[model samples]
Target: MALLARRVRPDDWKPIGVDALEANAMKVVVSTDNRSVIAGPGAGKTELLAQRAAYLLQTGMAPPPRRILAISFKRDAATNLAARVRQRCHRSHAGRLDSMTFDAFAKGLVDRFGQALPERWRPRPDYELMFPNDTAFRGFLFQDVGTPPKAIGSYADLQAISIKTFERSLLVGSPLPVMGWPDPTVGQWAADRFWQSSLHEGKKTFLSFSMIGRLAELLLRVNPIAREALRLTYSHLFMDEFQDTTQIQYDLVRTIFLGTDAVITAVGDNKQQIMRWAMAMDDPFSAFDADFSGKRTPLYNNYRSSPELVRIQHVLAQALDARAVEPVSKTAATIAGESCAIWDFSSPEIEAQRLARFVAAEMKAHALGPRDFVLLVRQKAVDYAAVLEPAFRAAGIPLRNEAGTVGAVMLQELLAEEASELLVKVLRLAMTKRAGRHWTECQEALGALRGISPEDEAAQAIFARELDAEATQLSADHPEPPASKADARTIVDDVLGFVGRERLIAVHPAYAQGGWFEKVVEAAAVHLHGSSAGAADWTEALDTYEGLYAIPLMTIHKSKGLEYHSVIFVGLDDGAWWSFAGDQVEATAGFFVAFTRAKQRVVFTYCAKRGARTKIATLYGLLSKAGVQTIQIA
Candidate 1:
């Protein structure tokens, strides 16, 4: 008789690195039931998910041939979670965990089984992806010729509606009218017409992510074979950033694995639900529990911020939610001096100068690098950049506006693209003289592009040699590194020409197929051109673009899931965050996210001349209640 293998208990698995799994965390990790983990910032949500995945995969709970599907809201989060799991589990076990963005997963399903969709809703094979703005929709309503039909409401009413609102209405085959729509029938008619036109453009189809999701749901709902196949393929499902999930995405999840045997573990903070404008479900935690019969587990310990910083965050938390549970800080204060403060300045110019001085002093005293500090604003980081960039430049410090656009693409988003990453890697390899990890990474990347197996050392060596030859040729072509904006653009173009655009596309076929690869390359060149003004050499320029040596300036929305040693909240006055008065809950959540990003210290800057303080009186009261010191700067 074959001997039964020993079962692995939660206690049997040791924490990797410095990770400390609390008793509750351990229970959640090993539990077989569906779970919804509500964790605050720094609660190690991603780490917990990673540990659970490792536990399930290592113990044969999921077993071979049955993979775990981990869907994250952001590409970077997906990449980070996958990397963490790989670090903890064996290679074979880790390979069974497929981590990808929700959009990517949805699009993959639609791309693969779109033909199975009902003919009435089938998308053409060569459909293009469209991100329609309000103007486009209005134009569609007007046919770009005259006023909209009388059945459709006024222009102001149309402006209030979003594409998601329209898509959601169409998905349910009914008009879930917005608050002020003239008539439900008219709204449905307009949505149907817009959707049909978008899906069946002349000789081409343009489908948004929402449209793709609708088709994915239709494909699964109508085809039991496809649904059963997916159910059998994935025994475990992990949803990260659950708060950011939209109704359509939730519907898709419910349609596929709602009552299936697959175990679902969703982790997110309700307080961090800042994507409501994008049609994120309002009460996803409640919905998850109701739909999947999942147990709710709240993680109250914050492992990121120091005690003082956590205390200040609590003050803001209470303002946002009266019944907010204060999160205990697992991190001790290591840095000496005030952990939280409000710096009030008489004018914007004074605020910028003082901010630069403070940052420089902190860098010297704490031995902090540019990446250790982040400057967050309410919105329009370019406007903040215009004010603060000059001061930082005068202080001999480099400041990069990460929220700024490069050829119509946000710099941060552009950098995260696969095409941009591959080009950066190639550039880094070209600049390196000695063979090290870069050479190996380049070889592995090339091997993946060419479908070469990792075990084939001979093939890898040949690729390595080919990479070396290319690097040598590149170096010979450019004797000196780029020193100016024009030089940087020229070098990037040279790399593209030398590496061949087709070869890069092999590594990033999706972006290529969408015609976004060229746009990404253009944005990369634009970013390099702008970065050249701040960097002294090619290496510095790359570092600046990568947020290595330059201080990052971004909007609060862009700073989610990021941590810094110190944070400066710029323009805390009413004018900068005007929307705070209209929607205090969301605005405060945005502030909460920004405040928690600080590991040791946080500074709030308010310029009296910028805006009146009446609109944000409650925030000031909270700061005072938290015992955060206020300094006056002239």
Candidate 2:
């Protein structure tokens, strides 16, 4: 009868973390302690979280705990694991469970603690044509600070933006960041006011983490009742992506859950700290000993990628460690999969598109389809649409990546500009019968661009801005615009609210039709009757179900604890490309992360002009140690 029982809970069955698992038995002194998980790429940190939570649930303890608190970087991830746990555990055994992203989790706490903080306008605004996102936020950060000292851009741009924004808020005492203020026009006085606010005794010292930390701290430390409840409610707190946490975030988490006896586990990959832009704070796992003043455990096994890939990945990450100037840990990882290779392209324009051509050619020769292929890129810096995507569409092949939404947004940005051009052309074409027909065709081509993404704030904004002009022109020439911008926003926002639910609730909205995507696309089609061509551009950009993809185009920052059959790290150039971190010894550790992502083959390509001072050189160093070949672009 005993032999018939399950050897391990399905939730506890993590093949990945088990491979990279480190028996830091000596490090974790307290039976109940904070376990700082340090590992290389695709090490399966998320999988380990499930395993540990499962162990806590199955055994329940000498006296079983009532619930398990699992936190993650993304709600999508948390929702996935929560559903999996529920499926794995029979109804009777699994305790009450709760999972949340740090943002959602913090918001939940705010409900209890921040009731009195003047949130009159904070009760979830009814957004009409609410904008979803803007590239200005991401691309603007790489902004040039301009001219003499005052005009220059640097990492300080982030700080400067914050300080400037705050000063504007303070000077006018405006409750919110001014909506229409572009960088140059944003109130300079506001920046000074923001700077002064930072000088307040209890205010944050550092600009990077000032907002997130200060907000969380305000509730925890200031609200007496809320503080007491936090201590009791989350006795055993589990935090994922601990590496990206800022100092104030660390302090807030540390302050709430009191006592060393309560178990706290922080799982993170320190080598993957590529968020200099987000002011991502660093917490050394070695310090867990003194901070928790307790035990530390290492989950060394990496079950995500192939062993061959992990070997190279480990070397890459080791090279990044500015601390340990030593060699790769002889402890081989157990990742299993095909090897990785990176080939170079002579033409950036033809690369993604030509890569598409290569893939289509491969598919035709090999009898493959879109399902069997994937395209991964580092920075979607330039508008490569004319390069790769249009090529794929011309071939009638589908592809998925962050490119989908970005492409849609890019099209949306062009709606206004394109419409003005098409209108003038049509008017002129109208004067000339033959040319008028072409102008009419151009108008129809302009209208098809839409956001398959439900809450595409960028597209919605651009569409709304140009809707009036398009409507007036259509009344005089073509049929009236399909729907007014306000109505379109109402319908689209409603639809997106549901689609966003999938992102927010994880698994809740299986039945919401079109979710957010249906509405956004519908809005695009409705808004532009003559512009089916534009619609095609927008529809072509939406990529759903990318998880099934094998290949990935990833940022060095996003590649943490993840691996692939092959990896191609692009956009490597000079001018602050290889700045070593604080710990000189730990510098190469980060390189180990990039190296270990490749299992069997490791190939790197960069602008040769960047020369010896590039990440590729560091790759050369690590590969030489592991006997991996370092080849240049053929």
Which of the numbered candidates is closest to the native, going by highest TM-score? 1
Q: Which pairs, if any, clash in model 1?
A: none
Q: Which residue runs of candidate 1 sit more than 4 Å off their true CA positions?
A: 1-11, 142-184, 443-473, 476-479, 482-514, 529-538
RMSD of each: 4.8, 14.5
Which digits, one per residue and each the tens of the lDDT, describe model 2 over residues 526-603?
A: 433323223232121112212222233434434444444344444333322445434333334444455555433344
How many clashes show up per model? Answer: 0, 92
Q: Each prediction's TM-score against the native? A: 0.88, 0.57
Query: What C-alpha lDDT, on a 0 to 100 scale, does residue 320 get in candidate 1?
Result: 68
Tens-digit lDDT track for model 1 on 1-634? 1111333565576655545787777778888999999888899988999888888887778877899999989888987898788667655566678888888888888777888776557778767787876567656755532334676656555545555455455434332222213454445556656655666645777877776776787788888999999999999999999999988788889989988899999999888888887768888999999999999988888999998888888888777667778988998887888998888888888888888888898899888888899999998788889989999988878899989888978888988876677667777787755547667656655556566665577987887787878888777776555656567667777777655678765444346346777778778877776665645665766676676877999998889999999999998888887877887778778888989899998999988777887888777787889898888876
Error of 2 at 308 (Å): 3.3
Give the least accurate 10-residue stretch of model 2, judged by summed lDDT: 124-133
Give the lDDT of residue 385 in candidate 1.
91
TM-score of 1: 0.88
> Residue 143, candidate 1: how far off, in angstroms?
5.0
